[model samples]
Target: MLIAQVTDIHLGFDPDNPAEFNRKRLDQVLRHLNEIRPRPDMLLVTGDIVDRGDAESYRRLSVALGQVNFPVWPCLGNHDQRENFAKWFPEIPFVDGFCQYEVEAGPLRLLVLDTLDEGRHGGAFCEVRAAWLNARLAEQTDRPTVIVMHHPPVEVGIEWMNTDPAEPWVDVFRQCIKGKSQIISVICGHLHRAITCQWEGTTIAICPSTAPQVALDLTPIDAEAPDNRSMIIADPPAFALHWWNGSQLVTHFDNADEHVMLAKFDKGMQPLVRSLMKERPGAE
Candidate 1:
């Protein structure tokens, strides 16, 4: 099973400009996905589909998403408003008002969780969301499941983007999933960068934003000198592809923009390629 994840679209960044930067970046991502090798079984638009969570932004987003050739599942981010998002994505399986549900694809089960806490930048998993996740995790102990959400449960070192692990919501989340071996990984976005770390006994993979990536600054933010800090940067739009090759799941991060190849696969590399790909006499 191959799953593609693209996040932090922030489509309506410039509310008035029709040809906005975010829209262009998002289009580039979708086009790249449509033409990439090994088409994804489904796409997960992790979160931050729009900037302000306005109706028009969602309207534009919904239309753009229709062009994808595969299924696209999206959850909410801090920037998304439930009411506005529902207007465009009414079919989302929202349980008890949160966009959290379990989806079964060929060899993997995905639990899309809503970590959006309205009017806040950080993430939160309230009692309702936490309880639901615990029950779901308990029910499906056999499948190699991946818990999907917007915010990274563990601190990512970016002082501004990191979430307090001791926060009440995060605490509850850790308590429920700690030591649970069934979960293969926790995939998320919100830091706006491709980050990987170990959390609670499993791996956590964070996808980069499609719009603009957050600058990788590990220094503590000095409140008095906020202007001196590096925040957002216009890096290449990117996404993550998660591949489950029967036994293990491997993830790769790639940019939407076409790469500038330094060498051709013709003449010079043919023998090397053949040697690597050709079957050995003793192999399966």
Candidate 2:
């Protein structure tokens, strides 16, 4: 099974206009996905779908995602408004104010977790949500499962960004995932940069954003300095392709410009031409 993951779209950020930097970046990502030789089985948008908690943003997101041909699953991020999201995406499954859902693709099970805390940068899974996760894990203890969330459970080394107050929620998540050999990986995307770490014997992968990337700075910035110190670089948009072959999950980071070709080539002379090029002008 092939699954494509795109995150941190930040749509509807510019309310008065249709064209915004983040929206255009999202369009690029969608275009890349649409042109793939073989489309993925499903597309997962981890979170940060909008910059602000507004109904209009959610409406725009719904319309934009309508272009996708495969199944699209979304989870709430810190910038998202749950009520607005639910109103626009009424088809999405949610329980006890948490957008947690399970889907079975062949022999693999996907567990989507909601860690949004409404008006904060970090995330948390409350008691109700934790119980839901535990119950789901117990029910499918025999099947290979992959947990998807917005905020990563482990720290990403960047000291300031690591100040998320969701540290308390890690224990609950650990308790549920520990001793579960069936779990293949924990996939997340909040830190706008590709990051990976190990937690409870499971691999945690934080995907890069499809928009402008966050600058990889470890310094603690001065509070008096303007918010400009936060991010940097307008990187090319990208996404992750996860291949589940029943036993192990292999991931490939795909960029829109991944394809490059040699203009001129002869099938039989290719190796001879390369060997000739390596030889000296008069020593061949």
Clashing pairs in 2: none
Kindly give the stretch of ten consecutive residues in candidate 2 with the minimal lDDT sum: 157-166
Residue-level lDDT tens digits of model 1 in 165-237: 8889888889878878888989999989999998889999999999899999887887677567668898999
For model 1 the local lDDT of residue 247 reads 79
Clashing pairs in 1: none
Put down candidate 2 lDDT per residue, 92-178, tens digits, no spaces: 999887899997777789999999987778888778998998899999788889999998888776766673435878777778899
Leading candidate by TM-score: 1
Model 2 has an lDDT value of 0.84
Q: TM-score for model 2? A: 0.88
Query: Candidate 2: where is the Cα deviation over 4 Å?
Result: 163-166, 220-230, 257-284
Give lDDT: candidate 2, residue 85.
91
- Report the C-alpha displacement of residue 237, candidate 2, in angstroms: 1.6
Worst 10 residues of 1 by lDDT: 275-284
